[model samples]
Target: MNQAIANLASEADRAEALQLQLEAGETIVELDPKVIHGSFVKDRLDGFTDPKFIELREGLKTSEQIIPVLVRPHPDIKGEYQLAFGHRRVEALRQLGRKVKAIVRNLSDEDLILAQGKENTDRADLSFIEKALFALRLDQQGVRRQVIMDALTITSKGVLSGMISLASSLPTELIEAIGSAPSIGRPRWETFAQLLADPSHESTWRELIRQEQFHALSSDARFERTLKSVAVRKEKVSDEQIIKTGEGRKIATAQSSKRAVKLTIPTKHTGEFAQFLLRKLPDIYEEFAASAANTTSDNE
Candidate 1:
């Protein structure tokens, strides 16, 4: 038995070394969890059933598939691996009282950030509201707003901005429901934010949310109906700026036509980077002026 344990440890070590290499840059097959963290046990032993556990339990039992997880070593986290993704898999392992399985990859600091961003962007299971909330957090992290738009494959900045605004405006409970709702999307959330801001129509909006019938309404129709409800009661205006229509509102704002330019230099020019930053500012203004002139000519 002791010899078996020793051999297992050796195999794990070898696997971990290979996985680390993959995380560094090399692309390889998915790795097992024992190789990454030395054990599959979850530190959190909560019995809650969530999407993560469901996927893991089903995948391990019914499907023959290798689940991918991002394992980053935590400075303060001890005993278990920090999950960059696969929150569900980690939890499911805990619930089943079994060893967790994962792909062990060593990621650099920058790579981890990019991984986190892309993981959130690529999730097909995320609801409209969840996507909005995720995007909002990414925006707050000082991740370039356009990065969120591009990486998420959002067609327009307006859709991205609307989601951010919707997440910010809704109540926490409602936000969670929104995240779970099947029919909600960027346009719906943006429209709902406008509706919820109106004091006179708060009850109706609350009812719409409470009953879950909002899912049945088309996004444009819902926004229009909500706005119409508020329009009739304009005399009962509260301190909040009530939107009677989506027009001229901040929700569906247009994207700026500016493209970003990145510059790299040799390590020796470290001191001259400040001058490089200064040199790029005028180019932005020049681009904006040129764009405006083109627009004016097209209109004329």
Candidate 2:
């Protein structure tokens, strides 16, 4: 049993013991949060407004940090360390005005993401959208797909693509504005992605999120309401309708809109009919003006 434990990998060996040691086999040490900088910050936070995060700070206040966070010397700044993972711990400690016990290492960008991803696996804590967005950010940083696959534990390119799609469904700024909806899962987030395909939905989101009422709701409720608004809007528009003549020939395509009527006349057998309508435009305008003038006179 003792030999088997010793043979286990460093990560899985004895996290308690392993976490107590740095990658260089040194013991964990305390560092000031102010001097610590964020590198590959894992959590997409909006001002650390999470109740759970506050819980973390409270927990740490009463106890020792069970998991040692990883940090490295600041690549540019002298005498400062940059955090690779465990951003929340750093943040909470930063707020508490305390030093964090961190494992110092010289980690590359790849090493940082891998370390963060491994820690994530141990916790399995990030929400689906968060993970997807993290994956997307790694891609944006020019990390290799296979390296991402290994770090994310993604099994297939297909799954990776799907996550990327979900992450990119909304603009980054928009998602940040709404905050991370922890209660939101993958299915609903995927639905939200589809809702954003409409340009109007993208435009309307800017308005909806600006409302005080929108901010009053819980994160999950905000996500639900925003997605539902888009869904209802899509339901209202029939999108397109076809008009067929008695002979079963296609006459026109009707597009539904909230404030306008749009019709498309095909150029096949309908070309002559379309020309005839163009010829009547002047008369059509005259009749429309006369009808409007009479209505104005009647109102007076």
Candidate 3:
């Protein structure tokens, strides 16, 4: 049994190695970075300023590029090529104004995505959300489920469906705003998705992320803050209560929630009652404040 397992593992290793092996007459050659374009379905969210990307760029400046990126002859453009994998390497080389070492092949769209996804799986650098978004983009382009599964190395249809659903639940603008929360996994993302089910909460999240202070935070911090903000908002609001008189007659309705309180009196004397309440509000508030201070002192 152990021998059989070893043989199977050996075959799997060989198969993976074969993917990077050169075909009959294929050879690695230097190509201008400008001529190599990104894949149709993006799999990464890290930008040029991302620390890891910057580290990659700095590392490339000191050592030779050991692996060649894969590219295919552009189907639409005559001389250009499209990148199947090694986007980060290509970007680093582009920034350095150096030629990219690549293996050019004639790959169809499906073939390209498969290669791209395989590289991502092997590297395992893509965050859960990035993979989810990548799967969503592939699905959006009408790629077959099997192809997406193979590309992402997903074994179960249920897992793939959940990923797509999670990505679809979020707004693209919101996701981009938060960036790729690398440390965040499915559970937190699912929790955030649940919070967003309320349309008002979704709106609040959108508006909160738009603020300058929110944008200043790191991607993971932004996600954490947003989740906490939404949760706090959820906790602050409670069911509206009916304000009644001593005899249990409903006189008004009061609704209170985070930062605001509203009172409604349905009687015809609403205007006069409102004026009377307005006149008494200062005294009522003063009395409440005095009581609150006394409670605090007693607690102390």
Candidate 4:
């Protein structure tokens, strides 16, 4: 961060430093164990103090099994390091009481941007909801949507919107719970968030989740049916009646009538067209009610 120290750094290092600052902003750069800065050594520190930083460090420690530390030299800032990528890994290393082994590459300005972009993108630990929030923040920070799309390898704004929308539906506790789980992938997380959005249906959804029924409805057909069933139940309607009416609504006459009288028939019905029609008929139309025409037709 010092001007004189920055002046001493190589042009490549300076450029890299500038780029990193531009992309991710300034922070305390951990010194390379091999190349000491001032009095700092590789295993000099105990652990990070900031709770958020500590959490990030713990996540990194857990993620070390996947990827190791990646670093790029900051040409402008001497005694300062540019994290090319592996932020989580670096945090993990710092947490684990180990020195970060860096590549020490002399990166150009463009390279630094690419590295930050790639690193932020490739090693993101956000859940579906978190990604949406992160992307939304980036969008507000003057980062182009296309740039975010490119960085995240996502094609449509719908995907981002869906994540945000779904997350917006959940309670903070639910969001935190989902975010903490490393095993929950984007798709599952998104689904969970979406379901949680409708509070009336959450209990049923939770029951389904408890029973591990999602496994049985893995296919598209079953999944859609499950969603529809829950949706109907949430609406306080019989799922079977809803499904039946839905099918009928699609193909029924398709005509806009001048006047229509809708009546509720208190019965459960399904199957052939005749059977469905029979269920809707007046009580007098039943075989047992031959003598008295007790029920009046709505549109007679």
| lDDT score for candidate 2 against the true structure | 0.78
* TM-scores, each model vs. reference: 0.48, 0.73, 0.75, 0.36
Best by TM-score: 3
Residue by residue across 1-300, what tens digits does model 4's lDDT show?
675455445435645755675477444444544432211111111123424457666665655333333455545556666555545456556557767655455665345434555554443433344555545545555566666666556789888666556545555433332233433456765565565465556666556544445534323333344456565564553222222264454222221223533333334332365466666677636654654444444335
Question: Every model's Cα RMSD, please?
Answer: 21.7, 9.5, 8.3, 15.7
Candidate scoring better on lDDT of 3 and 4 = 3
Q: Which is better, 1 or 2, measured by lDDT? A: 2
TM-score of 2: 0.73
lDDT of 3 at 69: 91
**Tens-digit lDDT track of model 3 for 1-300:** 986687577647745564547645668899999899999888887566788889889989998876789999988889999999989999999998899989898898999999999888866678999999999999999999999999999999999999999999988788888889999999999999998877657778878977999978888998899899989887886766888889987778876886788788875746687788889999999999999999999999
Question: Could you give candidate 1's per-residue lDDT for residues 175-283 as a string of tens digits?
Answer: 5433344455666656666666754466765566566576455433454555565554443442333222356432211222134223333335344654664698799
Candidate 3, pairs of clashing residues: none
lDDT of 4 at 171: 58
Per-residue error for 159 in candidate 4, Å, reads 2.8
What does the lDDT read for residue 279 in candidate 2?
100
